[model samples]
Target: MKDFIFESTPKIVFGAGSIAYLVRELNILKKKSAFFICDPVIEKTIFFNDLSGKLKKEGFIVNIFSEIVPDPDFDSCDMARDAIVAAGSDIVIGIGGGSAMDIAKVAAITAKNRKKAKDLVKNPELCEPGMPLVLIPTTAGTGSEVTHIGIFSDNDEKLKTGIVSPYLYADVAILDPEITVSMPETVTAHSGTDAIIHALEALTSKLATPFTDLLAEEALGILYRNILPAFEDGNNIEARSNMLYGSMLAGKAFANSSVAAIHAFAYPIGAEFHIPHGLANSIMLIPVLKFNLNSDIEKYCRAARAIGVQTTGLSEAEILNRLLFKLEFLLDRLKIKRSLGYYGVTESDIPRLALSVMKVTRLLSNNPGEVLLEDAERLYREAM
Candidate 1:
C-alpha cells in the first residue's frame, strides 16, 4: 500500500428533508448574517424564496448574490467577494450547482484575504480561512461541496484554472435529494456522468491510496447503478439520494487522491467552447479511459467489476475491452453523444487544446501514466 493521509473536514447532513436542518446548522455555527450565493435562475424558484424567508425569520440578515453563471470566471468571483465584504457577512451559504458553490468558496477566501481569484490561483498558500461556509449542492455533480478545490475560467486566455487548498472545504455540507428531483433529464445525465468520471479518475490516479480506492469503488458502484434511474425518473427520490451520496463520496475520494488526465483535458474544451463542465467531461471520458487502459490494468479491471461488469474467468485484456464497451453503452444510454466535432472543434484546434491541457500540471501530474504533449493531442483527436 502506498503511504497516504486521509482527512475529511465537512460536517455532512444527508437525507430527505435534510434542508430542514439548515436553521439548526446555522444556529450551531452562530451565523447571524449570511451572504447567499447561487445562480440567478435559482432565485426564481419557490425553494429559494422559502429558504430565504425562513432565514430572515430566524433573524439572519441575508444578502443574496445571484449572478453566478456557467463556467464562472474570475470576474464573477470578484463580484461575489465584493458582495460578501459589503454585506458584512458572518457566513457564506452556497446553494445550486457546482458553479455556485465554486464561486462561493473562492469568494469566501478572497473576501478575507483581499486577493483576486487570479492571484489566489497563482498562490493558493496565501489563502487564509475565510468566513464560515455552508454548501448545499442542488445537483448531483462536481462534489465541490466536499472538496478543497474551486475551479473557474480565465476569460482572457480561454482556459480553466483552480484554487486548491484545504481552506476551501465547506464547514458544513447539506445533501438533500428533494432539491435535485426537479432537475431535467439532461442535467441529471450530465451531472451523473461527471461524478462517475470523478470516481474513475481518482481510482486510477497515481496518487490513489487504499482508502481512496475503497471510496472510489463504492462511489462508482452507486453512481453506475443509480445514474440511469435518476435520469429516467427525476422524481425517484431513492435514485436521486444515491446519486447525491455517490457524488459526495467521489468528491471526498478525489479531494485526497485527486483526479487526472480526464479532468485536465476536459478543462480546455469547456473553457473554449462554453460547454458545461459535466458535459465536457462526459465527452472526454472514454478517450481518456482508453489512454490510461494499460497504465494500471488491475485497477481498471477492479473498476470494471465495481461498475458491475462481470470479469469472472476473463483475461485482463478481455476485461478492459468489456469495460470500454460498457462505457460506450452507458454513454449512449444516457444520450451524451457529443464529440469534439459536435462542439465545432477541429484538428487545428487540437494543438491549442493540448497546450492548454498541459498547463494544468496540477491535475496532469496525478495521471497514472505519463501524458506527453503528443498524447494530449492524440487524445483530443480521438475524442473528436
Candidate 2:
C-alpha cells in the first residue's frame, strides 16, 4: 500500500432533530444577513417558513433564492449569485438536495470573490476565496453538504461539469432525517442508489486507502439494509436515519478516494437528458461494474459481501458474477429503467456520448481498472 493522506473538515451536526440547530449555529456565527438557496418546491413547505421565521426572530434577515432548477445551468447560477450579492448576504445557507446546494455553493463563492458565476464555468481554474457556507440537507442522498465538489450542467455543450476545490467544502453540514420524510418514493429510490454508487466507486478507486475502504464497506452495508425499507415506508425514521448516515459516509469516502466510471458515464446522461444524477448512476452502475470486474476479482468479491450478497465458498470470478446478478435483480425489484434507450437515447448519439465520456478521463483515471475508451464505449452501448 502506498502512503495516502486524508482530510475532511466539515462540521457535521447529524440526528433526527438536528435541523433545530440551524438557528443556534447561525446565531453563533453573528451573521446578520444570510441567503438560502433551495428548490421552489421546498420553499413552498411550512418547514421553510418555520425556519425563515426562526431566523428572523434571531435578528437575521434571510433571503430565499428559490430559483434553483434540476441539473442547474450557468445562467441560473449567475442569477442566484446576483441575488446573493443584491441582498448583501453575509452568509450562505444551502438547503434542499444536491442541485440546490450546488447552485448555492457556486453562488456564494461567486459573490465572495466578486466574480460572475459564468467566470467559473468559463475558466474553472479562476475560483478565488469563498464566503462562509453552510449546508442543510433535506434529502438522504447526494451528500453535497459534506462534499468538496459541486456539479453543474453546461447546457450549450451538453456536458455536466463540476467545481472541485477545498474552498467549495461547506463550513458546516446539518443532516436531519426528519427533512427526508417528505421525499417522493421515486426521489428516494434514485438518491439511495446514487449513494450506493458513491460507496461502490470509492471501494474500487485507485486511491482507495484503508480508511476509505472501511468507511465505504460500512456505508454500503448500511445502504443495502436501509434503502429498500425507506423506499417502502417513506416515513420510517430508523430507515431514513440509516440511509442518511450511509449517504454521509459515502460522501466522506468518495471525497477522498474519488468516483470512477459510473460517474464518468453518468455525467453525459445527466447533461443530455436532464436525468437525476442518482438515477443516471443507477442505470450505468451495473454495466460499468461488469466491464470492470476483471480489474480485481478479489475486490469484486468483497464488494459483493458489502452489498449483502453471499460469497462464501465461491471463487472470486463466481462471486463477481453473483454480485453482477444481484445488482441486476435489485434494479429489477426497484423497477429502475434499464437502458438509455428507454430514456430516449438514440443509436446515432452513441458515438458522441462515447467521445464525451472519453473526455471525462479525470474520473476514469481513478478507476481501479484501466478503463479503455473501447471498454467505455462498450459499457455505454450495453447500457443503452
lDDT of 1 by residue, 44-136 (tens): 999989999998998989899999888889999999999889889899999999999999999999999989888887888877788799999
Query: RMSD for each model, in Å, please?
Result: 1.0, 1.5
The lDDT values for all models are 0.91, 0.86
lDDT of 2 by residue, 290-322 (tens): 878898776677889998888778878778888
Runs in model 1 lying further than 4 Å from the true structure = none
Which residue ranges in model 2 land beyond 4 Å of their true spot? 121-126
Query: Which of the numbered candidates is closest to the native, going by highest lDDT?
Result: 1
- Using all chains and alpha carbons, the TM-scores for the candidates as numbered come to 0.98, 0.96
- What shift in Å separates residue 232 of candidate 2 from its native position after superposition? 0.4
- Candidate 2, poorest ten consecutive residues by summed lDDT: 116-125
Clash-forming residue pairs, model 2: none
How much is 297 displaced in model 1, in angstroms? 0.4
